[model samples]
Target: MWDRLATDGLAILVIMCLIELIVPSRAKGPVMWGFNLVFSLMLFASTLYYAHFGSVPTYTALRELHQVPQIKGSVESLIEPEYFLFFIDLLVLAILWGVTLSKPKSMRLGRRPVWKIGVAAAGVVSLILSGWYIHNGGKIENEIVQAENLGFLDYQVAAVLKENRQNDEITDGNLGKTKSEVKKLQATFAYKDASSGKGNLQYFGAAKGKNLIIIQMEAFQNFPLHLSLNGQELTPVLNKLAAEGLYFPNFYQQIGQGNTSDAEFMSNTSIYPTGTIAMSTGYGDRELPSLPRLLEKYNYESSTFHVNDVSFWDRSKMYPALNFTHYYDKPSYTNDHFNAFGASDEELYRVGVEKLSELHKQNKPFYAQFVTASSHAPFNVPKDRQRITLPDSLQGTELGDYLTAINYTDYAIGTLVERLKQNGMWDDTALVAYGDHFGILPKLASEEFISSELGIKYNDQVSRYNIPLLIHIPGQSSGKVVERVGGQLDILPTVANIMGVSLAKEGFTAFGHDLLNVDHNIFGMRYYLPTGSFFNDDVLFVPGKGFDDGTAISLKTYEPVTDITKYRADYDYILKLMKLSDAYVKQLPKRGP
Candidate 1:
């Protein structure tokens, strides 16, 4: 409890000291007290945020404060009476300041170097102790545990130090060396061969001359694909598409701090997000090896469409780094006041089809990506757009709101498909659709609530991160449900294979494998889960200080496995793989401003 208190107070002290440095000598006492009050309130807000998200907020999280207007309702629900205790000191100080102001004379410590020195020494001692605490934590992969062990202020410092160390280690490294290492590591594992005893590269280039369209659905989960509520299908459009395409029900989301944008980065580049920062904000300056850069060689024009401003997550820089031929952002679409994004998914698709149709008229094959925003957070859908009616019990609940939004999003996709078909591009295009990340927060939508209402067993970690991945090949009449588990990292390799782009032949390095061909798969997740947590064929393994103390849950049963000894190899392999991914990304050439 004392450690926790110290951890919480550290931010207040730093803020107070910074305020003291700028204030005039005569006003230092009251001004310092006022700033302390303000800083305390910030601490209270952080506490509430932590309670809801189950993760400590870093300084970088402040960049997302502008998103509060869109999620105000959800944010309000997270606040509690206990969080206000952080402001108790502020309250006491405020009352004391009022009393002092009311008096004719004020108490003043005039030029007391001894007292100032003592305060400075105290701050120095606190810093030393915090550093010592972090050192004692001993390299835990779990961010939550690391924060708890080192406290919040120290955790931020440690995160920076760790990132710097990673950058240093890969400073002189080359992608060729990393590619060789990855090949050697993969050769150690026994992936399933094709039926002909040849490699599973048979499907490569099956759609070489086809146009490509990828839809990155917002906050959509796998459970809604065929599920019905009140005899009404939740996602009828996606259901039909899944029936006619290759659907991977076992696919999971692997986004980090950037969330949707990170999903975009992974799907396009096949590299892992560092989990310490938003990939778009941090590595957007790197000359990223992506689908756009590869397809450019085939005379294909690459473009991406989104309803939000390109500056929202720094996509302006990211697009150029990925070498996209063109992009359609907010100005390119009609604003329909769709949440904070300013335009509905329908408007986005309308604009997208118009632009792609122009390219099609010129007989140009193109790569077009649509980033949906209608089903974003706080999940409120306009009444006119609502397609599914909720049960009386869930009418005003978060789950109901989510379903309503998802249904609207699905309906909007139908419009895009219709446009494609009308333009005569459907038969010649290989369309891929996937969800960027999970929607419901575990605090609001508990396991019991989901199982009871949705009739689906929802494990917090495993099921919450599960998203749908569907790929529709032109003229393909039946769907195939691939059981292999995959993540956002696998999207690029899988799509490239379908497009007949050979990463190996082109000397491109991919941290992920082609999900359609790989018999066994393992993917790492670090944002919502711990850094070392990984999902394999049968289980989700989460590390606890180290492997021996770690835990495993059966993916099939969502129940804890008694013995996790057999999964040790997966833990080691994933840890090494993620480390290599981090190193490889750091070593990439940075694009100039």
Candidate 2:
């Protein structure tokens, strides 16, 4: 809780400082100091409470802050001071400082209209922003409250601690401690890295000499598969490859830490997801045993390719932790420029091809991991492709732009496939492509776009988590569609299966199953924010935590199963997964049995 308050306070203070710089204020110092002192005191008090009483009261306070607004249909219902007051306090202090610093008697409202206008504009902006901050904080608090009622607070608290711990100084002891935690974290999952079992590269088929390529496509969604009057087929290349590849149609992703590198860590290392900031931001310095190191035992070269800022998510250190021999980020690419997210997909694919060809020429099989960035928010694609126009339904909205970006990325994939075929590298190489997670369609947009597109009310928990996964094995004409639901965690075992490696028996007992195997039964838990969904063979549970003490009823059946304890157990699993995910990414090895 202090971490949250501290982070928020730091951000607010930074913003206030920046504002002061832009509009020099002499009189505001006293008010700013007073405001800071008050906030500091409040923060200290809260920290004391958290340490003494535990997170229970803090959690309770948070829950109470989210209660349905007393006044119906009031935006005030959305405002929660506890959450947003930290920022408000900063803004208020800054304003008070500015006002106090100003020589009011000498100040002329008309004499210096420019400064007055600037100050007024800044004040308005601050007030609007403060309002929004409060609203979102309240809204999120409500969601947290609901989740807590359903027993997710423990996981939430665990997530808070795990995230904070990662930012601590990276010491050998810390790394060693991380290594110990990995065992408990991985225990929550079923399968172990096959390489962990025998310490023999041959058992995991790393000796088979098959090249591996894992691609994490940003903001890829399943809606594009449905051809509409205005919606262009977004992934023709992947759809075409689906005919020749082993397609896992029912695969899901258990995304953690809302960052691409974190997704890569989870997918590659079979770690669970964390509920906090991007794992890369927090765990970049920790040492851990990752897939790259495990595969290095078989003499395979490993590399990571991200056509974006190398420092965006602290990828500089993370790639090394994963034991990649090389990392090719924006600096390495001198071709086309990137827009909103980063480099154009065309450029990314072209650069990736050149890199792959170079590695192939060396006669050393390599793991070339490429992360796509074009399909991210703002949906900036090259202007050359025909712009995709959505129906009246999505026109002028972010969804329309998002789909257009998807189509652009699909074309880039097509180009990549053609290049591989032309170079004769298509036959022996393997292609694994999966979306990082669902695109961010704001609530209004989700209702207008996703709900309309699917012809189903998108209110339930399960609808948002659906994504696409495609695995293409060169020259292996599987042409098989497997409907068994799986997630990124299952990818390791599935790859091991294809590469002909055996997963550790005890490891498979936790979370992942071999995708190619029919007897495996697995469950998945997914979250986007406060709301979340859990899926198993039996049923897909959409749990609203705060409503009626958490488990309200099946949105589909309206049958009540409000067992707070059950919800708590599920949340504990989520918490466990979050820790495991980070520990794995930091390449910290679990204590072996």
Candidate 3:
């Protein structure tokens, strides 16, 4: 019973409650203890159920809690039916206790009103519990099926610790020879694999190394370009760039590091963001085979530049880890100081133009990375920087603030392109720009507001994951839109493929395919598993696990899948991917400050 209490406090609550009724009704403090235990146990049980067998509501709640510093909304919208059911269960136990104590012989103070209260309480609890059971009968049954396979029920508190602390790795620090110890731990628990492709790894592919410039935009979504107030364009610069470059219509962002830095790391290195810490915060200064490092082998001078504090998210450490030879942070750009956030996007572009000119003087092939910062939380753009105007219908709020930042960034992109043309490198340089992930807009806003701005349903899985990817190679003329499902993880391998570099066989294997080529159809699992989210062309499946309360959403008709077992086989692959990412993340360097 003691062991049971440790493992499941809620189960013990039910037993304790029954025991209290055996005692006389006059036993005041003990009866109060039982009630307190029941309340505490119910809360604990809800948390345990979420930890072990959390369905959609639980998972969503967890994700929302970890949202970036500024976004605000209620987490109640994401809760599943299990939360209500748990309350009903506790209520029923409460009513049952009241009923027996209400007997006249058992309690001289017992009266008709006491009986009345018992009946009302029982009726309410019974109604709620029965309704929930009826509505989610299949889900509850499915959960019971999964529960049958339970082992020690050891809680995985690691995920919670990771979310809160953001820096505790499996190993104490750099594991050294104990790297093997970490590896053993991963193998013992079955960590996920991070790589996905089966082809030969490539390194420096540039026979004639042209300069490379990668722009990872923060919170840049496709919505503003699609927005039309009475058919007026909100984003002219974005529209211009779209026409000038190759836009990937189906490109997706597999969220990493919980924000822009994560997307930048995965896209730049093609490695899963797992283990001790996000590559940005943890591995930036460590040795890693990122775009800069890979390009360095081919005599390409590589540098990373960001329009924010170098210390923000620890990019100062990450840029060096990826082997960038030069790094320019906020202070690097003169006349560009505005917010503490970083240099404005326009100034970052201006500095890029200057740096490109300086690199031209050096007469060396170069790789430069720019991480934008202003479009991040707070979402405010400077008065001079704000280029796009919103109608009266869209003024005075965070959403409007976010829209202005995006427009300003788009304008900055246009200015940079023009700068490239002026420098005569427009024809030779390869330019790649993409959003790190979805913008953290408030979900509580009107659906029409989101749909109008983004050109798609804002809450849809596709909209959540889908962002823009643009690759412009002058004189390539092949501007056709590629509709294959791809992700931020595909960026490194795809760029390597374009540059003709071969990767090391053991060190780096890409989870993404080369989108420039038409051969591979690899798609990434979008969310966590055994019951998370999966993406394919024909359908979008979101299976709720630990219970039958799973959801499968279709992209085409916006249909939800009530019965998810039809795709049970897919869960195997999803779990495999999860293990791989976890394993490799554990393998990442856990260096000290």
TM-score of each: 0.92, 0.65, 0.66
* CA displacement after TM-score superposition, residue 71 of candidate 1 (Å): 5.2
User: Model 1: residues >4 Å from true position, as ranges?
Assistant: 1-3, 6-27, 48-53, 63-77, 80-82, 96-124, 193-196, 200-202
- Between prediction 1 and prediction 3, the one with superior lDDT is 1
Predicted candidate 3 versus true structure: per-residue lDDT over 1-593, tens digit per residue: 24333333433333344434344556743565566566555465445433322321222233323332323221233345565554565556567657756766646433346754664555455445433433343332232222222111212222233334423443334435333443343333212233545444322343236778888988777556646544656667656556666677677766633356678778877766652245566555456657777777788888777865666666667776777788887678765544546467778878877887887777878888888776765566778777667767668755677777777777778788888889987767888888887664334244567667545565545565568887765556545566666778778877776677754443454555566553434344432223234555545655444324556666555567567676554544544554455545545554455
Q: Sort by TM-score, best first.
A: 1, 3, 2
Candidate with top lDDT is 1
- Decide which is better by TM-score, 1 or 3: 1
Reference-based lDDT, residue 519, model 2:
36
Query: Number of clashes in model 1?
Result: 1
| Whole-model lDDT per candidate | 0.84, 0.57, 0.58
Error of 3 at 539 (Å): 3.0
Model 1, TM vs. native:
0.92
